[model samples]
Target: MKKAIGLFLLTINILLMSCANANQIKKGDMLFKITFAQGFSNDTLSLCLNSCRIVYNRILSSDNTSDGITDLQISVFKKNDSFSAKIFQGKEISCQADIRETIKIEIVLNGSSQSFTIDTKQGAYLSIEKNGNDLSLRQTKEQVLYD
Candidate 1:
């Protein structure tokens, strides 16, 4: 009976240790969805506009990949002006930045080691930039429900 109890205790300890390690190396994903519309204005100008949409994903499966926790920042610029928004899952988030643009969208992630540039309609703009230590929000699926 003593030997059986000792084996059971050892097995339980090993299982708990495995779960804790798994939690430390959590993997996450996020998705950014943006929509743009022309602000109410009397100016009737047809500007040469280009619209493009792109998606990005990152996976942190190991300690090396998790190093992006510190330099996670999001920023947006439009018409040489600055704006802000909230892009975090909750209060525990490290940092978040949001910008609305009338011409372009730029994204930098993983401490800006990887980045992207996008152009939007001249009359409107939309973009979503996400960065963090955890991958809570990721682009699991995307569909163009309408055009």
Candidate 2:
């Protein structure tokens, strides 16, 4: 009977430790979904997050022009109110950002450069669309749907 009780207590302790560790590894608070519209033929997309010192550039291409829309999702985690940026291809990139500061977004698409600032206090979902020779940046609230 005593051995059984000790075993039960040890199992409970292990479970509690795992639960605490799970809380420490948290998902990002903000998720940025960047969509590149079709018709991009070896165009360049440059992004500068938070600072202008380090610029992340990506070559935009359409594998199949008929249905070749490229989407990149960036997850922003806030820790101690500091921010940094990194680039990853074909995968979601996670970074830390300060909610109180404005994030600077610089894009050089199709030989034209444009800059935009975003406040991520409430999170953001940004879209980049190219129309003819112009590029537009738009931010929208993300909708959560449960099935």
Candidate 3:
């Protein structure tokens, strides 16, 4: 009977240890991706995109955002990289002539803004969102929304 009880206790201890380990997240690590428009004119648009990428790196490195992670794991891809802007029917509109050529950026966390360029060009834009429950709260300094 004592041997059986000892085996049961050991099983429980192992299960508890596994559960505890699962709750911990590594520091300075992130999974994200950024894609840019293609066939850029080596001009402002490209510049902006490059600037945005730099800003993105800064944002990712910030402990104020990443919960104290030092290294970032981001996957980047460039699609067709060709898009067109037009003034049609007295209205300004944009279209992707090479629909395959476009930009896409995604990150693990959703909140705050990030900047990046068109690739090697100096154009920039901000990425912002209010993350709900999908984001962990331990690393945040302000009140987060959960829904």
Which candidate number maximizes lDDT? 2
Candidate 2 structure lDDT: 0.58
**Candidate 1 error regions (>4 Å):** 26-147
List model 1 lDDT by residue over 1-147, tens digit each. Answer: 999999999999999999888733122211223321112112111111112222233321222223223112222223223232222331122212333333334332343333233332222223222323211222223322221
lDDT digits (tens) for residues 76-113 of candidate 2? 44555654333335433334544454677777775587
Model 3, C-alpha of 82: deviation from truth (Å): 28
lDDT of each: 0.30, 0.58, 0.30
Clashing pairs in 1: 29-137, 29-138, 30-137, 30-138, 30-139, 31-138, 31-139
TM-score of 2: 0.59
Q: List the residue pairs that clash in candidate 2.
A: none
Model 3 ranges with Cα > 4 A deviation: 27-147
List the RMSD of every prediction in angstroms.
17.3, 5.6, 18.2
- For candidate 3, the C-alpha RMSD (Å) to the true structure equals 18.2
Give candidate 1's error at residue 26 in angstroms.
Answer: 7.9
Count clashing residue pairs per candidate: 7, 0, 27
lDDT of 3 by residue, 50-119 (tens): 2232222232232233233222222322323432221112222223333221333333222333332222
lDDT of candidate 1 at residue 128, scale 0 to 100: 25
What TM-score, computed on C-alpha atoms, does each candidate reach? 0.21, 0.59, 0.21
